[model samples]
Target: MSDQESSTSTSQTEGEVEGELDEEVDTEMEGEGEHDSKHRDSPPLQISSFSSTLRAVIRIKQKYHALKKRRQEAEGDGALTGATGRTSPKIFTFDGTTPIALSVPQKKKRKRRRRVMYPNRGKRRAPPKPARSRAKYCLYLLFAIVFVQVYNAIENLDDHLLRYDLEGLDKTLRREVFGQQGAVEGLLSHLKEYLSTYVHNKPWCCPCTAPAGVGKSHLGRLLAGHFRSVVETLVLQYYVLHHCPQEADALQCARDLSALISEIVERAEEEEKIPLFIFDEAEHMHGEILDVLLQLVSSEQTNEYLNAIYLFLSNLGHSHITKHMLHNSSSTSMAKSGRYSHFVKELTPILRNTLEKLHVLWTEADILPLGLLEKGQVMECFLDEMTREGFYPDHTNIERLAGEIEYYPEVGGHEYSQTGCKQVVAKVNLL
Candidate 1:
């Protein structure tokens, strides 16, 4: 066997032996008399190792006194080094003399008149992390952080493979999007087939970009945390709110965002390349930032990353722009390509020409049509979120309310259905 494998095997055997020895030791050393004698007879090196493990075990045992035996066993097994000690496993390290549980100091009882005689007795709070060997403590802390990180990573991997244990946003969609019988099960299953023939076949390779939020953001994020893919999530804070960096803030942010994009792109592994960039709040981006991004997206050097993708999500809302600004061709959704009459109001011929060019260049034939959510769809989405948080909608109550409102004509008039059945529906008298 290879040295590494041999070492691993030895450790495993040692762990098993240590566990058995620990159980025997604990049984023998339950009493104070037996524990002291065991410690005295143990060689110094052995005693030190035992003590090191024992201190941890003692702390764990205290935390899990109800499951004292199990916690001690895990600590003995070296599995309960830290937090897991609430259920620490014990290894049976032994020369076979017997087992011993080391005795720790007991907590003192509080006196009834303590506050009266000594007002500040328990009032003096201890500081964070007691004074200790600075270097050793720091080293221990750093090691601990690394250990926990590795452990959590492994645990996450395990959860991802099992998928039933998937947590967070991706988890919810798994049964729907990726599950065997999920709602979008066919889509995810056939996704591989579709990917073989999927997009970016345009002759103009400048931006092989798909519409942001064309499911890329969700796909990326889900992939990152899942086993089947790399860190697939796109950090798309920019796209969600179309109105980022209002007025004065807009020009500056739009320019600087290129730097942010560059930093993230550089840090991301090439194998996990981002094919889409979801700039959600494009309206807020400085024109310069948008320009730089367009350059990046269009570059041949940028698209080789097989493991990564770029997504830009934007609300595509025009609520904050001026009337003249809105008239610019770029202001309309890409899905709407026909020239609007209102677009002729631009004061600056240069800006107008630039906007027209960009609008045409960006939206040409490739734009995905907007698929606005139906009222029921929006309600279902809200209900799903609430249900996840333990707040289910009362269908009977809502139906009753709807019926009562419909019975009263002045509530919302004949056109009530088009306006929706929200709370204020009953108060309208615009007629």
Candidate 2:
């Protein structure tokens, strides 16, 4: 019971302490509430002083900017006055204070634009061409073919029978014959006439007859040399008596002659050139061969492009010609006549008869007898031969040789050249 009483006293003391602590706390709370209320009741502290200060700062900044602008303007004016020697305007601030200078902003420079380059930009490609026409292609092909054929023909020209060894003929003429000016001139005139006849579209023939070694072949050569430019080919075919094989009969001879004539005619047509065919030692040709040659020349096929000269050199009927010359020497009437013209007139009939007998189709006008070499001509020929043989004989030796050469009237008659100037060189050599 004492313990319970003690417990109650302690509890009562504890409550009183608690109540006192509560009261103190209430007072503290009231004081704090009053303070807070006073603080809340009063108007919020105004920031007007700070706001006024900011305003002053802003005004100062504006003034500073104006001063700086004015100072810059004054400096610029001073610089202008110093440079130009002129009076500068005064720059002053509105507030009348010393101006402050500020840095001026610099303008930026612009960059230059560069040209851009691309690979192959400047190159231009050509447009594709149109197709060629068939006609043009065909024409080109034809031309190519023709050109090839012509080139081949020209390359093979040496293989043709019409082609001859001109160098050999030239050598022979230079070595074997000399000094027959009259004969050469007469032959040239005949050739010119033949060319004129062809130009006039007339068929012509030249039949030259003379004794052996009387410059008949030589005259033909001269004619060839003169007309080389005019004639495409100058063919000389020699018919050597007893030299040709026995098997070369009349038919073989005709065929050979025909082939040669055909070649010449073909060449003439193809080359567009006149041809001259010389038959040397023509008297050795068979009668049948002559007939074939005549037929070939006169044929319509040949005559179309056969603007050619057929020169036949022969020894036939030379005796008759010489006899006539001898007769002219004896008879005053014949002597009064022109020798060549009269001889031509007289010899034509004999040539006609002889050729007709031989079955040749030739006319009297075709025959032209070659002139015989005179004594003077023989002497000149001897001198020429001596010179050719590397001998330089004086005038006395020349006169001696000339006197030593014998002349015979019976051989060709009328002091005709019996040896036909061929014996002169041999006789001079003997001397």
Candidate 3:
């Protein structure tokens, strides 16, 4: 009976140990279930975990693409191929089940190609040029400037005064100065003597008095042409002292005359050329201007070079000269005895007196009287003019032209035309 009772106690102790182990297992299973239920009930915790895992996957993909791109660029090929001839490994997510293809960034194409080789590459260029070369360039530029200036000076030196044809003077005289042969020859002789004095450096002044259309200006121009090399003609009527409407007042005219005289004096001094100042229509000039002219011509200092000639042309003493001729030539015998010369001598003092009364600066010695032209001389002039103009007129035409010309007793009766030789050419044109 003792042995049976020990065996029964051992069996009871084994049963009790098994029951405690079962209870511990049941409690652990309940705690695991509660943890799983809390995880399911809170969605924020699950989302946070999933987001963190997704971010980790994205980061891993970026790293893989960067590495692949670098390798491909180094190998000069696509991301799938490597420099070592091996394919690039594919990337995966954390689960290793989902494959991830990280796209490698492409390189932009270059607009311009870079040169791989150059002829003078890796070598320094030549040193700066020498100063001697720069100086030579400067000298060339200076020489060009000097050459241009010398060329301009040569051009200026070629300048000359404008003058009329001298060869036509004889033709003009034969055609125009018909019956005034004695008067013209006498005047020309006086001019020759005057020019001789001028050549000896003696200044001269002359006043030529004549009726209108008696060829005073024409004669003056002929004389000017004769001595063109020494004479510079200034026609007052055409120049600053003209009778145009735009002429300045008397005072201004005097000023202009002064300026012109000063310029002429300076030019004469510099160029050694004589100035023949011809005052045409002297009657139109104011007495003040005439006085200024007289002062200019009379001044010894102004005419120091004897390079001036003042020739005053006017009709101022025409009537007096005509009357003197008429009174002295009352008879044909008296007229043929060179009575005009005597009359001129007689008229000098009278002209001086008249000029003095008029406050004129000129004296009787300056008077060079031009008389009326003859009818025969007028006919000769008309015929000469017709020949010069290429016209062959018949005797009837010549007679008609002669009849058209009017004669005035005041101008030496039939010896001179009323308009002198001025209208002779025009009347011939009408025929």
lDDT (0 to 1) per candidate:
0.39, 0.60, 0.60
lDDT of 1: 0.39
Q: Which of the predicted structures, 1 or 3, would earn the higher lDDT when compared with the native?
A: 3
Superior by TM-score: candidate 2 or candidate 3? 3
**TM-score, structure 1 vs. true:** 0.33
Give, for candidate 2, the lowest lDDT window spanning 10 residues: 83-92
Error of 1 at 15 (Å): 99
Native-referenced Cα lDDT, model 2: 0.60
Candidate 1 regions with alpha-carbon error over 4 angstroms: 1-229, 232-236, 239-244, 247-251, 269-272, 283-286, 300-308, 314-361, 364-366, 400-431
| Cα RMSD to the true fold for all candidates | 43.5, 26.5, 29.0
> Which numbered prediction scores highest in TM-score against the true structure?
3
Residue pairs with clashing backbones, model 3: 374-415
TM-score, model 2 to reference: 0.51
* lDDT string, candidate 3, 1-431, tens digits: 13443354334434443454445445555655575577777665567666765675566556556655654464455223522323333353365234446779999997997877544866966778866667889999999999999887655433322122223444555445545555555555554445432233445677778777777877776566555543443322323345422435776777777787777667666755556676777777775687677666654553543556677777877888666655544433222226556655787777777766775467534676777655555676678779878789566677678767777564324345667678877876765
**Clashes, model 3:** 1
TM-score, every prediction: 0.33, 0.51, 0.52
How many clashes would you count in candidate 1?
56
State the lDDT of candidate 2 residue by residue for 1-431, as single tens digits. Answer: 23453355445544554565556556655865675587687777468745764675566556556654655575467446743112233353455344446769988887977977555867866678998788998999999999999887766553332333443444444455553433444544564444433332434576777766677766666656645644546454545454343545778767876776777777766665567776777767766776676675663644544576677788777777666666555322221225556556767787678766765556533677765555656777777778878788667787677667566554333454566676666776775
